[model samples]
Target: MAYYPAEVKEAARGLYCKRYSIREISRTLGIPRRTVYHWVDAEAWGDMLSHEGVEDAAQRRLVLLITRDDKTKADLQEIDRLTSALERFQRLREREQAMRGEPCETASAKPEQQDQRGTREKRERKGGDSRSGKRRGRVIKNDVSHLTPEDFKAQLHQHYFAYQRELMQAKHYRNRQILKSRQIGATWYFAQEAFEDACTTGDDQIFLSATRAQAEVFRDYIIQIAQQKFDLELKGNPITLHTAHGPATLRFLSNNSKSAQGYHGHVYIDEFFWIRGFKELHKVATGMAAHKKWRRTLFSTPSAVTHPGYGLWNGDWYNARNKVKRQQFPGFKEMQSGILCPDNTWRKIITLEDAMAGGCDLFDLNDLKLEYGPEEFENLFMCGFVDDTNAVFLLPQLQACGADPAEWADYNPKLPRPFGNKPVWCGYDPSRSRDDASFVVIAPPEKPGGMFRVLERFKWVNKSYLWQVARIREITQRYNVQFMGIDTTGPGIGVYENVRIFYSRATSIHYSVQTKTELVLKGRELVESNRIQWDAADKEVGLAFMMIRQTTTPSGAMTYAANRSESTGHADAAFAILHGVSYEPLARPRGGCRVVIG
Candidate 1:
């Protein structure tokens, strides 16, 4: 063991507290990285680092530099700069406290001015002044009183892409239905639009998604936009903004029909095609915005054609239900550039190509094409819905498995032990074309014939097998993992070997025709029985399951397979889930099946 002086150790600790990487600290202090790690662990440096704020860290560093026997000119300069910064931070804190109506030490020293200010405030309150009138009611946290319509338009014009402007231009229509490619910033744009509308018009904005977590994405985007564009921090769920007109509430809600009953506002439904029980949800959603003043916006990438929203998309539901004479609707091509239909709905289809043409440069077109299969590419990015007739797992049956994970009162992912001593099954499907691998954590039934809930699923791309195993090991520390199933046909074999060393319960699954058949059959049985559930927001799981199709091998035997070539990183989620569910056997051995000769 090499000895490090007290000064050197103190310097390393200071650097660590200053947010330097351990390797960086080690190199700077001329100590071995292992020694620094040991010191950090033994002295609990991480706890100190986390609890120490910026000002405290700077003060500590300044003290350390001041006590040093040998200091450079740069050190003296940094000391002077930090001292000035600390003074400025103190002044800013005092100003903030004064603004918040708290008596600051400096403000208290001047009693005459404080007394005059208090007298004026009291007189204004008693005399029914306009400023005091605005402050008399419930205090709104995010006040946008000074923001003008021109200010909003300026921000929008500067930040929005061309397609977003098109959506904005069509805001006059009462009903707008958009079919868009995945990840073209539709949710973000809608969040911005809703916030602006709520602020300017004082109209309530309601955002709906398949699950509460998904709905919060809208809330997050709104908060981010407000802070970035206007330097305002909005607070509260269903945030109420105090505007020039009045107080406007922004409600973020899941597709729970019961929870969405009474609100009246402009409604935005995100990923409507992927939501289960869409007809019921749509009924509640439409009822909320039944008034002529409220607008309805529905937007999503395409899902399976079997979804109920498909009828609404093709105008089949509209034509069949209405007693009025049936009207001919525009074809898909005619609607691509947007059209106002006879049903009084303005509809548009924006494919990936259209988004690119509209100047969204966020995606690499070639990479996306190479990453997804032809069918997936068309369905997910070209506004084409899945034709699931040949699929082994139909959308309707899989829809039964969609659930809101937020309703699980027992599980909190933020905790260190989210499932706390409850046994969870883990499954891994290794990468096939060095593209993508998937891992899942599934909570099995507490009682016989109960439900299996998928708690978490992760996808890794182009990572080594050791890294995958390390992640599995970390998951074990957080979960009570009783069973782990790993596909050992290819790179999975390496993962299985490493995992089994630490987790004795880890099971190796080698794929053959019979094994694949058994896995798919077991998974299908679970789905058909409605015994499995996953987060409703996760559309990928349903898509992965729908990718599997029945085909014949060279010997004319029926088999199931998904597109798993290099061009398409396919169905890993479905197989990972199957690996976990396969822990439950296809069948218990019957009494008659046992041979006496055995």
Candidate 2:
């Protein structure tokens, strides 16, 4: 037997817990292998290893190392490696449990107690309470007590652009109004903000978008942030988070004011300018956050000036409400710099240029300018409202065509056959040079005079004509496509020719002034009669229709045309839709008179 200091024994034990071999521990600690083995047996180290998982042992070592005052560089390196290993192990465990259809333990649960807790739950479910013959209610837990405001600032807010940070700093205001450029991440930032607020303050959070699909985007972002940043799996539709304050609910809703009524929480209304019946939706939103403690945030890209939300943004609505005491608001330039209006609303205008200056590197300015023509570029990325007065499709009429896709109980895009033997119409508008081609799947009227529902829309960029035709063929397999209309001008000729080989019902449309007029007129009738509807989230469809203005041809004849060029035809989606609906014929069929076109 050889004598060893207490420090040496402790060092050997620590190394052994870190999964070092006995021989390695001996060599590292300058001790004999026989003595290390003797200490390990005497201290019951094998029993400890049997009781603790690898993650538990690593966590124990990591905590010991972090608490030491005289840590060497090697100690810090070991800490970093152990932390990373623990994270990877946790993720792997979660994946394995998911594969086995087992529920993962909460982040706050100890590894040693997880098995015992799961077994207890199973036993409780199998045998009801011996006395009452009632099973215990299943606990729905979303433990977020470990999360601090500091954690959110470090993990999430650090990645925000300058404009996003500005929005955060203005959280004290009762109301926030933001007009931003497309794809500038306004919704993304607000999702994080609301989640953080809900987690920390236990305040209920509500998200309202133009459609349920858009509202779910916020919920998805929140779930992703919780999982990636904090190792939390937030479940349930209106996710209930168990925070230190209490349990708080996060609700996601659409612009249907009737369904949104009676909810009280912090409300975030997304894409308000594009929402139909904005005035009614605004009333519902205000009622939701009626309390002084709750906040309201409204954000969107600019839509047509005729939109009801435009009045709320430009101060006209406020002026009308306060006719006796009118207050002057800051000009557009001043608003671009962000300001608190006299009505106590914090307002800001963030254009693509402002977003770029604020550290958003997602767009090439010249490329976007060329992709969307001047009018579209101005409206979408420059925070300029559309003047739809001269357009064939006015904003009010086009807005009336917007509907919530969630209301369609018969359709599910996730299924293999979304429409399930029901007849569908598909329309394709081929791309011009450097411009995106548009395709649409529409559900025609169910009865003699019912509604036309746009089910799906796709935009293909820089794809070969063969690829486009292949995609169309795949759609035919999924849907019982009764009619397919393709424009046979420019690149469309290639697609139409190839599609005709497989789908005989494919119709070729040759574009002329008269042809376009007929297509535009039929579309107009559909819009005016409230017969055509699309997902409210598809604001681009409305913008596309707005692009078709009454124009004069080189011969001075009146014609309807978008800002068309090799680089700038933004009406592809609108034309694609018109192409599909044209199969119904320009004039409505009278009794016993069915007029169909191929």
Question: lDDT (CA) for every model shown?
Answer: 0.82, 0.83
Clashes of each: 0, 0
Look at candidate 2 and give me any clashing residue pairs.
none
- Cα misplacement distance, residue 418 of candidate 2 (Å): 1.0
Q: Output the lDDT of residue 43, model 2.
A: 89
For residue 308, model 2's alpha carbon misses the true position, in angstroms, by: 0.9
Window of ten residues with lowest summed lDDT in model 2: 106-115
Candidate 2 per-residue lDDT, tens place, 1-598, comes to: 9776454565566567656667657765567899988998898988758887788778777755654445679888998999999999989988987898665642434433443553454445457467886767454366665577999989998899999999999999999999999999888899999999987887899999987789999999999999899777788777877665566789998777866888899999999999888898999899989999999999999999889998888889999999999999998899988899988899999999999999999999987776677887898999999998778899989989998775564466766677655789988887565636899999999886789999999988777888888999999988889999898866788888889999988998888788888889889989999999998888889999999989889999888888665545668889999999988877665753534333
Q: Where is the poorest 10-residue window by lDDT in model 1?
A: 589-598
Q: Once superposed on the true structure, which residue ranges of model 1 sit more than 4 Å away at CA?
A: 1-139, 322-324, 565-569, 589-598
Tell me how many residue pairs clash in candidate 2.
0
lDDT of 2 at 81: 100
Q: Compute each candidate's TM-score over C-alphas.
A: 0.75, 0.76
